[model samples]
Target chain A: MSITGIEIRHLRYFVAVVEQRTFRAAALRLHVSQPPLTRQIQQLEDALGVKLLERSARGAEPTAAGKVFYQEARNLLTLAEQAAERTRLAGDGRLGRLDIGVFGSAVLGPIPRIVQRFRQTHPQVELVLHSLDRIGQIKALRERRLTVGFNRFFTEEPDLSWEVIQTERMVVVLPEAHPLAKRAVLSLAEISSEPLILYPRTPRPGFIDQMMRLFHQRHLTAHVSQEVDDLVTAMGLVASGFGLSLLTDSGRKLHVPGTIQVPLRKADAATVDLCVIWRRGDDSPLLAEFLQEARALRHPPPEDAEPVEKPAPRSAKRKRAPKRR
Target chain B: MSITGIEIRHLRYFVAVVEQRTFRAAALRLHVSQPPLTRQIQQLEDALGVKLLERSARGAEPTAAGKVFYQEARNLLTLAEQAAERTRLAGDGRLGRLDIGVFGSAVLGPIPRIVQRFRQTHPQVELVLHSLDRIGQIKALRERRLTVGFNRFFTEEPDLSWEVIQTERMVVVLPEAHPLAKRAVLSLAEISSEPLILYPRTPRPGFIDQMMRLFHQRHLTAHVSQEVDDLVTAMGLVASGFGLSLLTDSGRKLHVPGTIQVPLRKADAATVDLCVIWRRGDDSPLLAEFLQEARALRHPPPEDAEPVEKPAPRSAKRKRAPKRR
Candidate 1:
């Protein structure tokens, strides 16, 4: 049949008539006058070129054609209701999927626990958990794959949206009896002079660089020691008393027995928010539910945390990063 | 907010666009040209007062509003599809729930076996088996809560539609050593005036009525010793050598010790059909599937089964009283 003459409104009206029985009853149910219900039904009949209802003194009955049409009409209505539920979640940008692309880091910590709990509370939604470092997360979010996921919180991408789902404090893992462990929560200034373990530099400056920058800001001389890329291996070297390196509490579940974590006292230390990024217009019901669940678990909004930032706006670029597959 | 202003078709169209991504693509997919799809989208937008599309040269994208709309659109679509499926099932008279009013006697042999097979094949389709008599089955089908169930295949029913899913001639249940049990088959003519046992004429007409009608046609006389309301108890009496009586296959499954079933011949022998009854015009897809499955198992098309009798003209009237529930 020609689709040009059809409208969903007609099906809704038809469903109302069958459910309510009489045109008057359907009209009352629809909260409109009886004439409009009749009009819509007639319009539907004319459009479909079939008389759907056979009216009688007793009530209205569906013709054979009407019977067939009703099956399709009802299917269309159910989908509409689900879409409305998603829209209600979009106001705070805190709702919906956070497709976070993870990159290099291997060990998972308490952040995983937080995410798992969020899922339990909103089981209908799904989380597309992936690995990509900050650069990749930003790109995916711009393309609308993620509503929230890990990304560099410091990035100035305007069209992207982000809110901290959790904050992790930078801490040094060391042997309980080590020399640096005895100092207890040493300042960035004090820690700079010690030999340090480091991660790769190609993927933007690592956390060690951020610490060294703080050291330079304070005119402190930092000692260079063995550099390691892996966090566990770095922690292993610390466990061996080789050197101490920084880590975050986000993955406290990865705590090694021989190593102890002490809070850093650097000016830029203590904590950084793991900002969730999403395209501005990206709307997913499951994602919105996740954002709401995240907010509920984190207690105070991400704004009350140390991370001070607005979500990025919708970007002008299409992302074709061969990653869609 | 106003249900009258909306129809399920809009949501269906909206979900199609969101799922398919691109008005022209969705239009072509739906077998409609782009112009009508555009108009429907525009009208839906106007009604919802939300701009759902971000059309660019390469393709259209969901706007902030569109994403919100998509979520509800999908939900509505799911429910509507489910409802349509139900309607199709209901109309087929095979779709809705069937209480299947049946007498205890009917559940014994072929009937119970048939039902078990039906359940195993259609697990999700609920078929509530009720221990209903001939009267109960007719009443329940009329009330519309229950659909097809087993019953006595004695008479014709006009208000109800039924078929003899299975049929069997009268079989005499008797003590093993009884003289008649030694015979390959016994007819009313040979068993004339023998001590007979059967149900009384209360809720159901006595089996002797059908048997006697056969005897009258054969110009023979039969004798009765005791009367019981249920065939199970009567079979017990027969097994105990109190009397001999005839029953359908349903009464024979009990296989009471010392009793044996011998085929009995007569003009109007007792037979039963595990008949199914559903309201006319109850177009349920589930029911249709059920009937198709059942018909496939039973009829097997014969490579030619009467062109599958298309909704017979002047719906077959039940000549015998439609067994009332």
Candidate 2:
């Protein structure tokens, strides 16, 4: 006989006998016959190659080795029960880590609010945020490092799914002394010839590409002043009177001392969208709950929301749209 | 469905499917049919109320929740296997604690050797030694606080069993300058009128009682001097030339600077036996192994080893006995 020969039932029976202090009492507690209980304890001892209990005329008592086995068995049973309960909680998406990939100005506004709501609802889940751009987000998602990603201008992918969480019309950042800063709203065509500081020089097909596409669609060439790494660098250049910069409504939250933001003419301004992306068929409940929270805060679109590839038509449709809060 | 609806087999099946990445592959590995394997995974997902896998023409892949559950299930299965293996080891006496009650001079000699040998053989077993006297040993054994105890002059009780491990001849401790210390051996009658320091003032029916009984058996009155607490105090009194003290051979290991030990004449000396006591019918493998080690160091008796109550007859039998090493 080997360790494998001992079964979970054998442990239950032996523990019952030792606890109840009599085979007859154990059988009654287990709702089994006394002979069967005795035989099972015998089999357990045989499998272990050591006697676990000493039986007398009065009752039964565990030997020293039996006491040790009893504690181990009880712990194992408790762990087994806990495993099932934890697995169920995991399936419900309430007891695991959610790694989120975030980027740029999105972290300034909507993302923090959504994260706070998620924390309030699912307190047990750990939330990890990785600051990654659009291309990095997609790569991390495919590598299973990110459960979900939030960013702008995500191109369609066969293995990834994207959903528009919010839409913001473009805004232009100008130095406080610039002539355009006095206007309530400025048309992009009016400042197309002005020195413009575009951001995020690397990771092509990003926000810079979308900005260039907006200028090209209107038959205007942006006078490029300097190309920098991120939104903060571009805003800094604008603050120092180097050039004017363009941003989404979310970027307005960054209040530079010497810079002011002016809304763009809705007819000429392209609407930029913030969308969430994940693996195409990820059915994780955590992802579902997060998406639900995002949808709850979704901005009502002026027109049907479309991917960044078709930004020209969205601008044309926004000509008659009313201003939003 | 509730967590209780899930079984260990369901977890096993689900983990196999997730690891193999397909029902057919998992079935091949588990030696089961694909239909039943698919059904089991479905049942597991249903019980959890979560979609654990995404099935496509390529293969079945685990969802995010499925990944979490897979880890938990694997850990639970491993713990179950460990539980069985640990219980078997405990039963085999190779993986538990052996709490020993030790007192007085027994810690000096044979006890340490037996403990060292036990450690070499069973490295995983923990040995806890509690300094307890004869009465304390009996009480701790009854309370299940001690797996085994070692001391001298243990009275047989209904609930405790004892075996003589070693039979030690008595020795007289005196100041090195005393005339009796020059002799190789001295009889009890010669020292009957000498001031004798007795030890263990409390816990009567102990070593002091055994000493008084030995003198009584010889019809000699002991001229008791100072009564101290332990072996060290008695030896200290002997070294200071206050009074002579008697101890078993085991106590000879302690060498007080001005004191020397001389053997008691075998014909008049009462043989003190070091015996191990335990709860009757303990049958713990650890206890059994410890007893085996103790018995291996047993000193062959001059005649038959007897309990402390019958030490007089053993002394009579040892009159013609030769000296032991």
Candidate 3:
């Protein structure tokens, strides 16, 4: 027999008959004429191949088979209603999943703030953060792999809307024994003259490009000393007296031994903006809550209002300045 | 939102679109035109408040929200179909429960054999045996609490059909030390003069009535010495030299240490029938299997063909004779 032969209509009819205890009453309760109701019940019995009710002069009663069928039909209807309700919630973005495209360093900054605040407010929403490169995040967002993304690099994707959430000034990380280590704040030109190390040389047009653009805008070439693959490797190189590197305050918290992180004088010019990006026309309900939390974090209320605790990475090991060499 | 608004038809339409990957092809496959298909999907989206498909020059593709909805809808449909299939099986008596009403002593006779054989063939059937009295069995059968019953008592109930399976000769049970215990066979008149003991005095119209009817037919009065509730208690009474009793061979198997069972000479005239009863026109599929096994047991295969070992209750302790009292 075909499984789909029994549908919601059949279940409703069976439950009605059992509850009403008679076909005549069931028909009246269901607002249908007796002939059609009887025909429907007959069809349901035929579909199930079991005599659900034994008709008598007084009323009808469920047979052993009918009792079992009634219970299952009730269960099936309940599950169907629950499925519909949950699916509706999922579609409305009140329930279901949110895939956030994240960059490696983004996890240390606004990503944590946005995720923490979103989880607190919308605890029912499933949050999945996919660590990807800026290009990967952009492709995934377009391919519908991500609901939203947190990244620094911005490109002209007319189909997407990017809103900058936080901007941080750049800093110079130098080996303690370096000549410029004593400076509280150093100019970009003075640091550019020294042998400078940059990270993640591969995956072109990424953070490396952002660093290179800063030098190119000034019409000065950087003294390339070493090209390392990641922030940890760059920090290791600086600690071993290789060269100086440029990064943000979040990077300074790494605290590499024998290294001193000094703020750059041209902070306003050499800065990076962490932005939240999504498809231009995509008005996902959950994204609105995320954007709201992110905006609140970017601009906290006054001191008289509830305190906004600064989001810190649990792995932070910040040292203002190591013993001067 | 009203959950009932999202019916199975809506899920079918959504799945069709997702599978065909284009509204035009989906509508064609679904035997519906494109406009209606588009409208149906829009309505579904409106109900869910989420954009399931992203329209493009190539075709329609599922958004992140659409993908999740498609998966959930597919699952719900599959579950509903399975529920229907199982319910149908239950209605057809191919699956589901079978409650067999049994009497206490019935377990010692063809009941165990019938149950074991039925279970072997109908492994998928759930068998539950409820031990009740003769009246309890009849009442339960009428109320649909029992699918079938194993009983010997027959009443003039036009609504029930009773099929006698086995009839066995009655025998005499006596204290080992009694003078009549020496006889290989005894007549009703020989034991009628002795103090007779009856069992299961409670639950009217039971085995006691059968024994009483035998003596009444013989036009002889039994000299009852003691009345007991169960077979074990009766056996204990006989072992204490209280009186003699009438029982079948199956009952003889419950041999007490100080008692001896002897075949009565008028066994042919003093017999009882064991029958299986069910409501007339009550066709439960599992009952057919039970009847088949029971019939096979009644007329077992020849000794050389396959030895049908006689079923005996394990709790038996027999003594041929004891010191004459």
Candidate 4:
């Protein structure tokens, strides 16, 4: 037989003989008889065309080449074990990297808590966050660069699916010295006539469009004063008394020194949905774990009640309401 | 079955399915039936406690975890093959390390040629040279730190074996302007009364002892003049017109500016044997190859003669002669 005929069992036999220092001891350790062990080592030597061991009355000793082969064989066995362990960890979603697309005000609210909970549960999974607009998020997700994306509104696509994590009621930001700040809640009509600062100016069909649709639903025109790129810029304008600005509930976490956030009247307050989107058939364990953590945080169980009784909605797909935003 | 039960064949089967993208195609490639391939993949996933593939009308595609496992499995398979190839190479003595102990004037001659020839034949073997006397060589060999050692006048040891590679007739070194420089060959009786410089003041029972024994055998007395640590110092004294010194055949290569060397008369020339020593039972292929190269260079094949007619003596163990130095 040629060197190609040397199998894993041959290596096992040779290593045992060298480590145990005798064919009889190795056979005992392997739960086999001595004759076969001797035969296998002879076969291995013949196949490789070299004598690896010198057997004597004392014991068997590895020649120079056998010592080198022993080290390589040990490394191979260890690597084989590591391969299996890493694969199992990856299978359990306890290892590997997860790239997530995040945009706008989602970073200011529930997203951080969801990410924290996921990290605490699966610390080995690497979470890479990318800040992109809705259009950029969709493109990156389709390109497989992102495993999941979070945004205010997502248009339905044949190859993509979106799930609403939670709905946030619109809140108005007014200058601290303004009369509307004194009221606990205000109607959109009360503020519609006032000059408004909107965002973002680009990335069409985004948060700015959602805000415009809210005004259009009431058949009122927004008296635009300034347009900016992000919530921080619009908040800066509102603090300087440029105009009033609207934001989702999560935006309450951002506190500008000269501005106050007041809830809109419930009936007139338009709700914006924060949803996660991904390729429809993605079954990545890391994505599944992250989604589970997000939904659990969205609908936390009552403090005194059993968690099993309140089942989280697997997919809360809202009715397509005229393609709202 | 548990994850520990996953074997090489399971990995092979799963990788084939993923690469081929279907059970039927994978089976065709693996030369197995489709149903068994499908069942093996199911067993692999069950053992891992993770779903690895999503089968549909189009074909099978690996899930995220499956993708990670696929890469790791490929690496493991490649490593396994390398282990076999490396072991085979090592068995043929074409790979590994050979540590050699060397000392004194042997490095000036046959040792270098033997080392170069061995390196040419087994280029991958790492040759490490240690400057050690005969005692140190024996100690290092017992500790397994040395594969072979080369020196002159080895004393027999219970656990070590020595083989003579070649014998060199002694030569005398004198100042270039000395009257004796005119002779083609000299006798020990000619320089018996001249002041002589002896070398290797330390490491007793060494070359100095051997030189002293040679004088006693000829019934001559060496008039001692100076003692130095090494051959270079001894030769330096001789070049400076202080005294004379004797060296083996290889030492003729030393080009001291004011010194000239003349061979001793054939009857009066005491021959020194250059030999290699190692642990008595060491059957290392590296040592065997080195010894063979050294002997081949010593008795080169005659020109215009059949090389097969002369067989090299495997072991020329001379009778122990009163434990000579």
Candidate number with greatest DockQ:
4
The deviation in Å at residue B30 for candidate 4 is 5.6
Error of 3 at B56 (Å): 7.0
- Model 2 regions more than 4 Å off: A1-63, A95-103, A123-147, A172-246, A255-261, A264-270, A299-325, B1-43, B51-61, B94-99, B119-136, B143-147, B154-156, B172-245, B255-270, B299-325
lDDT of 3 at B144: 90
Candidate 4 versus the native: TM-score? 0.78
- Candidate 2 structure quality by residue, lDDT tens digits, B1-325: 2344566677678889988998899999888999998888877776666667888898899876678778878886777666656666666577789999998667776899999998888888999999898888888999999989998867769988888888778889999989888999899998889999988897887788888888999999998888899889889888889989988887788888999888998898578777888888666767777776777676553356453222121110112214336
Task: Provide the lowest-lDDT 10-residue window in model 3 chain B.
Answer: B311-320
Q: Weakest 10 consecutive residues, lDDT, candidate 3 chain A?
A: A309-318
The residue-by-residue lDDT of candidate 4 on B189-291, one tens digit each, is 8888888898888788877788878888989988878888989999999999999998888888887999999999999868888888877866665666676
Q: After superposition, how far is residue A165 of candidate 3 from its true place, in Å?
A: 5.0
Which portions of model 1 show Cα errors greater than 4 Å? A1-7, A28-56, A61-79, A88-94, A97-325, B1-42, B71-82, B108-110, B113-125, B135-168, B172-190, B200-204, B209-221, B232-236, B249-325
TM-score preference between candidates 3 and 4, better one: 4
User: What is the Å distance of residue A85 in model 3 from its true position?
Assistant: 3.5
Q: How many collisions between residues are there in candidate 1? A: 74
Q: Could you give the CAPRI-style class of model 4?
A: acceptable
Chain B alone, TM-score, model 4: 0.78
Q: Stretches of candidate 4 above 4 Å error? A: A1-62, A188-198, A201-229, A236-243, A266-270, A301-325, B1-3, B9-47, B51-61, B116-124, B175-178, B187-244, B265-270, B299-325
Q: Which of the CAPRI classes, incorrect, acceptable, medium or high, describes model 1?
A: incorrect
